[model samples]
Target: MGRGPPVIDFSPFYGQDKAARSKLEDEIRNACLDYGFFQLRNHGIPENIQKEILRQSEDFFNLPDGVKDKYNKDVGEFNRGYERLRSQNFEKLTKGDLKEGYFLAQDLPLDDPYVQARKWAQGPNKYPSEVKDPHLWKKTVDEYHFVVSKVAKNVLSVLFDTLGGGHEFLDDFCDHPIAVLRLLHYPPQEPDASELERGIGAHTDFGAVTILLQDSTGGLQVRDRRTGDWVDVEPISDAVVVNTGNLMMCWTNDRYVSNLHRVVNKTGTERYSVPFFFDGNPDFLVKCLPSCIEKGEVAKHAPLTVSEWMKGRYADTFGGSQEKTAKEMVEV
Candidate 1:
């Protein structure tokens, strides 16, 4: 077993003590720079809400295939509904991932402007009708999304401060953000499964940041930057694992890391985890932060809106063609 990611107590950041907040900021900065991953404890989300969401997720996934298939995501849909097992292959070198998932974003009505315009990942979610208690399921999911979204925003504010940016630097960027909450289920691997088969293949996330709530049955692993070896990210009770993603790496001009991670469920029991991806506003331009660039260093990546980057990545993963009009809209 390799070393676990750092466990960070997030409650101090919310306090009024300047010295304590400063120390916590330094710890977060080091975690982002060195590991790109850390376990966040005492985040404001309630434990009961977390448990309820997981329970609802398990109940939904436990439904028969025919029943669950009613909500299957369309080929071109980026974030909307259910995805069947082996639906994605994050690492092309390996077989399709062995996990199934359901995707939901900021719920919008049919009359919402973004939904009417068919903006990337902007639409109402598809909820299953076959759950044991449909109303409770919807309520739990909505409540979790609402609470976790605030935590994600707070985490981003702290990260920006550490980068020498203003507290409100991300205010506009997070307005109507293209955030996604994914409920993932990984079944036990087959006895004779090849090494090439995995629950989720090695890949880095495409968003700015991800907050993951993992269960007791642990299988998530992160690749160590220094040794090129995979390290286990053990599950800690009531702690959500937070990691920087590719967009953050680009925005910081590589000052912060976006380390690779994957899951392999060797344990004989089913595994479920929920990850909230805060990808930022669709129209917000992601350019390298001025503070992150050294005196004479040039930015590594050109500026691109969150929509452009996310759409391209979704197209690559799902093998869907990009819409010409949407591409042009981002260019303008």
Candidate 2:
């Protein structure tokens, strides 16, 4: 097994051995402080589920353009559906993304009458039934969502311990956090012209953390904070790439930086990546911890719920158009 800097086997941490857990916790802390992103191997997410997701995603994308358009997210502000190429703005805050994507959120209770009424915030996901093999696509995507959710929660446990808190600290807050998994498809382009374009532009995630599963094409790059150069993030088989987000940066009082990254269309080969984002429950209160804050140092941020903080960042990062403030969402 090829081990990168600060990459420790997480399996030992889950054991009852206090000594092993402590050692791993120290490693985890170093990972957070230094890289802000790490590659995880032997992470326990089942292989079948991962393969199935990729297989189905390929099938879904192969569908006719008209059928894929049936699930376009741009039809509404909720954007809980498919996004064709150029649907999202990712380059220079002005240009649109050159890639296509499928956006899926945690499933909610459909029977709730208010669910349908809140058209913008939460609405039913538009499953692409128009595809040739609708059943296969729907089933695979659903299975992928459940499996990734499990892996994400497990990662949260390590973060909880590393942050000097118990798993309950995160569990109590993330009953069903505003988590999302985005499946992206960036096809190979003309060599000369594509170098200037991008699959997804440079931007920092707006949530607490993101777990990414990328193919071996190696188009992902992270900005080296000290050198101002883009470092290629190579993909290893069966490994997940994890990174801290804006909320985590705030909670850590900027001790852990949310490094900027972008996807370059380097190889003349198609690339597919799945990035799972975990934003703690909206109502979960977030405040600077004693370890992160000093006696004389003023707290940079006031107490705010995870949801409120996330909603604001989402609006800025993803361009949520809702006029309501975080306070207004809480009232509803």
Candidate 3:
């Protein structure tokens, strides 16, 4: 009958730590092992900044469909720009998600090496020029991305400390990492809707870690790893909810659970939440954690590079269609 997730403060673990750091590390380690989700507070992100980012998001989402469509995923190749409602088949459109989103990737220059390589979903953001407060929206989102990415790295450091490992294991993969910032808006739903009328279907995140900034209108839920039940992820003010993902599970050698979660936005009011997905370098090799595996036991999964595994997962979920630029057809 519990109502919410653990609210852990990051201040105790911030730079130049002391006794409080060790205690917090133990707490985070246990929380990761058992819950795999927790809201982090005192992570040094100012309240006004978070609110402004939400405001900017609301403005952009409320824009006319014609305007938003200008930056749709068809244009950005599913890596950046707006994703129309129900376009993503999280549960094969069985009462599919009643939400729309704006996805932002690492804003790389056109001359960047990755851009030249024509990689998937790796490039600058496609913003709707007609948005109200375009400057503020871009600034807010970009700033939030920078701050949140740093916080996620700090969280990883805590995880490494918990695992009794050095930064060498994950540090290289993070430098100029492939990060995704998603802003989602869920419309109001009929109170009589069924359980299958989900705002987002049951699923686990794909990357290393997800840092979520949820608004007051709450609907997020986590599946209990032990019981066959769902627990409400009640939104706490000034705290970002963080969760491990499939990649983390792989890296941890199944030591931690990347529990499945779904969003059922039954509330009659609108809901807004943004999640920052920090992924690894595409080329990083993923294998069993030496600590997680016993002295002689074999690793459950064979070695796979991050990029290869991601491509496989995508091919399995979304077909193996060749991706072209959003402007491909329009190009002369």
Candidate 4:
């Protein structure tokens, strides 16, 4: 087989038996080690839910720019809402990303003081008035979120176990989680243009984990950790791509890595990808896991609340800094 990005058959992991399941886990581990990315098939999220989410996303993005702006995130720290074309920083190093995104996040309770406090970082979502059916956007997207969150829970459970932690290790951290699903629409690039320079830039996700569902038009690329070269990450219908994020690396004591990826307009057609980014409560303390640190390298990171760490990370993210500060945790 050609030594390109490792493409494994992940269909067996969907509701499989212990032996088969262990094999799948091994594949996930190897994928993380060798490629830092993998194409997953039959991952157990329903097809209808995925379809509905995409359709609603298309409907929302198709609306006029003015109509979409009504939902622009006003939350104190969060940029969750409608980010106009070229507004996001991922494209700052270049011209801009050729995509527009609608961000939806978990709605905080009305009486919660933190909800009132972080008006910039969190708030209620805004829906487009042009959505002919009032419930179409919310109903579909909310249901889609519910389903994916369930999948995230199940997968993270297994991942923690793989890291030498018990099955319930990640359970408490994400019980009442804060997550966002980005609805992205990437338009086709003109002929004879350098898509890599104009399309989505190479970057790693900021949350704990991200599950991406992409349409047929594939422009996604993932870096091969061993080779240090970029390789295409094509979409398999009925499949979703799962990758580690910054917080997870911190939580795991750097045992696993958060992969770097980007999207280029290569299919000669427009593209869309919905990524649900999941993480623990912003206030949760993030410390290194005992499994990763050994006898020699001393833990260097001090205790930092997830919220505080993320605030600086988010600031750097807005400024387009690729380097993230990894705090080593003190041994428990």
Candidate 5:
């Protein structure tokens, strides 16, 4: 395989020719099984939407620290609102990540059952008010979330099909997915920065899959499962990187890889990236697939809901103290 993640043309998946679609499916399946990461081109998201969101990201992050702090995520909030630089440390032993970010998910109304129940990561997003055009900011972010979510679901459908399961296998599971979209900005590291300092530390994603849109300033790296070497995931214009996550590995009985990845921005220029984490329905049980289990081998993990798994992961990354009840103040 090439030094970086494989690049796959995703347009054929939507085409009418079954043979072509199947060939692409094989490529996707292999990517997940081997590299656990790949880049997709012609994935259907509009170019304008992509460009607009990045523009919005830069604008929001450029605002004064005081203005951005108003929307800072609360101590207990696992997702939503802004998080300051060095607020999170993904690698337990390393320093806090040297990047700042904004988090958002489906803007559920206060009256929604999940919101009422205070489900983890189930709530409305907190948008910054200081932006030049607050309305446009919200609109662009919401539009990107809507379109990218569809792409994520399509990718999931193909993954299910590859495991001898039908496309509808994950239909209900995706209905109210625990999706979170993060807009991140990584400042240039000092020339003599400590090895422990990172834009974001080496860690596997906690969800089912991630779709990442990165700017030209690239420093992302993925660990090669075979050789245990970290390989760069360079920027590809108009293409988004996709990677498998821990939940996917559990569902497939570890047949699919969920590789470790991290970022360290040595590039002098600022780096920005948007990553959409599609973790699937909170209540959906993640159990091993029959096809994934060998003839005599049994499933490796006990069945659990998506929420349970996510809660533990958030606690691990954000610290146990940060885990608390969802906010009482709700937005429609």
Candidate 6:
């Protein structure tokens, strides 16, 4: 299909007529079932805050290599902290994922319950202490994280109703989620590039939902399931792109799809993006929604907790399941 993904406005949720709410729900359902993605606007994040977040990201990524490297340790098995470019390899690329990133999570302490449980990826954020402005970058990110989370919870509410569940479907897990906010920087590419060169590999997100913010220099592409072709997810001014993830597909019993996507940067300018992943509480049980299972259809997955599924997926990506590989690498 040559069509672009749908644009969904969530105004109805802010006390509108019942008819408007119904129409929005229908759009949400159709977008999820067919496109696996949608663009959102009027989601309540301030414009100034978005711009400041991007500015801080650019400032941090522009820091000298030596200064940045001091915090580049692969803590918790590469889950958070500074990761250099080309450190991660994708099977589809001759080069590795060509973007460097700083991974962050809700700032927690060593004695936090999740950390005490030995849950990997749960820790305090890695801040650049030597930077000229104290907490400038950290401030922007922390504020943006709080802002986007509100947007995600609102989206989740719509998703809950779309699956024929009530408002309480996601209420239990939204307040204390296991989410991560990643800031990515893709350098400019040569004017003439080969097919093998890629900014990021084709893969599906491992969590439940992703909300992304990027500059106008667009390079994101989504794989079309019906035609088996790639579609450009162009950057629309002031719009945040949202997509479902693998665990969400499982929860919906395959009613929704988690699309395959990749990124490439050929615009001869640095590209930056921020993607916030919304994960459920570690112990939240993710089971198929009753409405998703028809009379003859059966649930596709057994009852599984969010942390268990996420950990298993990480293991699969890191080749930790194979007997030989498992011995060589520590589990994420």
Candidate 2 has an lDDT of: 0.71
lDDT minimum window of 10 residues, candidate 6: 323-332
Of 1 and 2, which scores higher on lDDT? 1
Candidate 3 residue-wise lDDT, 1-332, digit = tens: 34355789899876567788988898788888987888888987789888988988899899888888888866644478887887655666563578899999777888877677776456788766787777877888889988888888989888878877566867787855778898999998788776578788777777689999999999999876677578999888889999987777776777876777888887799999999988877667777677777787776666666666556455433445534211111100
For each candidate, what TM-score against the reference? 0.94, 0.87, 0.91, 0.86, 0.94, 0.91
Please, what are the lDDT tens digits per residue for candidate 5 over residues 119-219? 77898889888898999999999999999999999999888888886656578888878999999999999998888889999888887999999999999
lDDT of 2 at 5: 30
For model 1, name the residue pairs that clash: none
> Against the unseen true structure, what C-alpha lDDT does each candidate score?
0.86, 0.71, 0.78, 0.70, 0.87, 0.79
> Residues 1-332, candidate 1, lDDT per residue (tens digit)?
46767999899878998888898899899999998999999999899999999999999999998888788887334457888998888777655899999989888888888778777778888888899999998999889999999999999988988999675657888888898999999999998888887889887888899999999999999988788788989998889999998888887988888888999899988999999999988888888888889999998888888888888777766655744212221110
lDDT winner: 5
Give model 6 RMSD, 1 decimal.
3.8
**Number of clashing residue pairs, candidate 1:** 0
The residue pairs in collision within model 3 are: none
